[model samples]
Target: MTLLADRHGRTFPYLRLSLTEACNYRCSYCLPDGWRADGGPRFLDADEVRRLVSAFAGLGMWKIRLTGGEPSLRKDLTAIIATVAATPGVRKIALTTNGCRLSRHLPRWRAAGLTALNVSLDSLDRERFRAITGRDRHDDVLAGVDQALAMGFDAVKLNAVLLRGINDDELPRWLDWLRDRPLALRFIELMRTGDNGEYFERHHLGADVIEDRLRAAGWTPCPRAPDAGPAREYSHPDYAGRIGLIAPYSKDFCVGCNRLRVTARGDLRLCLFGDFGVPLRPLLREDGQRDELMQRIRALLGHKAAGHFLHEGKTGITPHLASVGG
Candidate 1:
């Protein structure tokens, strides 16, 4: 069996699958005006998703994360979760969302075998959150996080886009909140996408902003796991939660890239900021095509680039993070 290893000796043990391109929040850093019509094909159906995960599972991919503008918009989301969970080699099932509907659907989602969660929570202040997301669901999102904490998930991560002149100074508020919650809070440095260049320039805060504060406040670096996401985590004895920084601009950020992303339309992205995507949906129609599907993916891995060129102002075809499951 061929492991999903690239030419650089980097292997992918995790996959991020986009279920839908639809999202509710118009996040300032992402879908500021909400999800727009991209005129692309419809998202993968349940059966297509099953075949997709099955092929990846056979290639030693153990972790599958369902991402989207918001995954809950799909009516068959529970079915999607069950399908991924049932795949033989897949060990973890996770989802990343804006958390507006988390509490409403969490009980069923967990019952369907979902294990971990990542919620986009850009602000701690109610009004600020509303301003950033263009929705008044701050209380709803926090309530969902609280419920997820009590539900015995493997882990629940809170993601905040570090924006200058916005939520950048809320680290103290986050630390105070994390003091008692057993959550993993991540501060992701804002990245430049195709349509958000001007916005990115204005709001993009260096992750060092948080790293410096974490160090000054006595947060020590924590060892990373083999299949962990691109987060440099830190912990402190007094705090119950952990803090992480997902800074793509960092010198060595892509050294531990262990995952691949599939867009909602079934296009495989080698690098989030890669210049091209290979369409995989054509081979995902039947179980009998598993061999060809895996082979196609294995061959493409050899072409995977060492890293992204966001520093050069080239964001590929990614108009927004939601489109490619970012």
Candidate 2:
């Protein structure tokens, strides 16, 4: 089995799988106002996902994250989790959800061997949350968070997209909430992609802004978790868990990127902000092609550009962020 290493010798061990392209929340960032009319998305079947995960896990891939418009929307999500959890080389199985449907399936997911979770929660205020997500289920998301904690998910991460005039004011409240809660909170900068071009232009808050806010709030920088993304991790004087800031647009971490994204339809995206991808479905379906898949994956890893050019004036000739990996 060959380990996939990039041109810079960065080991490619993390795989982020977009289980489905459909999502419940019509967030203005990734998708436009009416995405269905623009174009329909192709979702992968459970068997195909299992096969791909098995092959990659065999090729030195260890960490797997199930993402989606909202991964929990998949009816067979638990089964998928079980398959990947049972894979030979897989050591960690996690999910990134919108938290709208987490409460109902927390037990099932934990039972299926999910070790950690990353839930998207931009605002604490109900109306604001609804306005941002275009859904009126903020309470349900909060309830789901509590249910996940009760279900004993080891690491419960809250991903907050830091919008300048929108959710920026709520940062302190989120930090205060994390002071007692055991969950790790992450503040992510807005990226320029999909229908978010204008939104990102207007509300792209960087790490410096967040660091200043944390400093004013008397918070200090802390060590980042080993497997966490490029978030500038931090902690308050007496907080239980930690806070992280993912500044992809303002401060790119592609130099330390150890992960790659595989779209639901078998497209291998070397970088999250990459415009192009190599299709692996055809090769995967061919007879006696496991070695071929590894070769293609290695080739794609070598082609992994320096970084994703998703900032202003950058273009990714591929699908939206939702279709790639949210």
Candidate 3:
């Protein structure tokens, strides 16, 4: 099978599928005022998701990540995982969740072919966590992290969006806390996408400063870990796991971006920071149109932007991170 390569020759083998636009947390950076999925198509059923996954896998997609406002909020997540796992070309299945409802579903999800996890955790302090996420489930999220580590998932990554004056002071504490763990801690730079331009301007902290702090504090850069994603990984000589920095703002991390995002509403987003997407629900709903659907998908892939223009001060690509399956 031919790989899904864009005009820039970037072969997209990974797919990020948004299961739902609904989330329980009102993260200040992601969704400050909270979100409600009262109207429109709220979510795709397990079978619909399975068909879509199969279609992408058939196009030589190897890795699949289930994302959402909070993927764990979906009751049929395991079923979706099972279906994706059963697809022929899908080599790995991963999840990105807020971890609020992860503890109860970890084992089942693992058994259903969840090979890895990326839990969103911004702050370690209980009150600070509550303040950041607008929810008081910090301990619960930590418990989910602990459970994931205990369960020995192949790759358990912690994703923290570093914001100035919000969770920046906890960088040292974050490094110390993960010293004895086998999970990877990624500190993401704030991006000015969606409706958070003002919020980003106020709190955006670049990864350069964070790296400088780490280096000044004696965190040596170890050999790079094996991964295809965007994190620039590092480690302390005495630490068990590694530290990563995803600086999309201060630095361009999209040179080799090989992925596509499918929103919960079935829009095929060729570029995360692009303003346009192809509506895929209509094709998916039409039976006996897999061939045509695949063709349309391939054609859209050709239109993938060379790179996100956010570094050039482009905005309005997306309204919110939740809508873009962040």
In candidate 3, stretches whose alpha carbon ends up further than 4 angstroms from where it belongs are 217-227
Candidate 3, 176-292: lDDT as tens digits: 798899888989988787678889889988898888987887777656432357787787777888888888765447776878999998889987788787888887774577787
Per model, how many backbone clashes are there? Answer: 0, 0, 0
Write the residue-wise lDDT of candidate 2 on 1-326 in tens digits: 45677778677678999988777787766664634633544577787787788778877988899998678878999999999999998988999998887777888889998999998988999998888889999999999998887777778999888888888888668767877788888888777765566777788877678788778877788774445567778777678778887877655477777788888778998877676878888865644777778777766677878777765467575456677665
Which candidate order results from sorting by lDDT in descending order?
Answer: 1, 3, 2
Tell me the lDDT of candidate 3.
0.83
Error (Å) of candidate 3 at residue 229 is 1.7
Q: Candidate 1, 54: how far from true, in Å?
A: 0.2
What's the true lDDT of residue 182 in model 1?
95
Each model's lDDT: 0.92, 0.79, 0.83
* TM-score for each of the candidates: 0.98, 0.93, 0.94
What range of 10 consecutive residues in model 1 has the weakest lDDT sum? 1-10
Clashing residue pairs for model 1: none
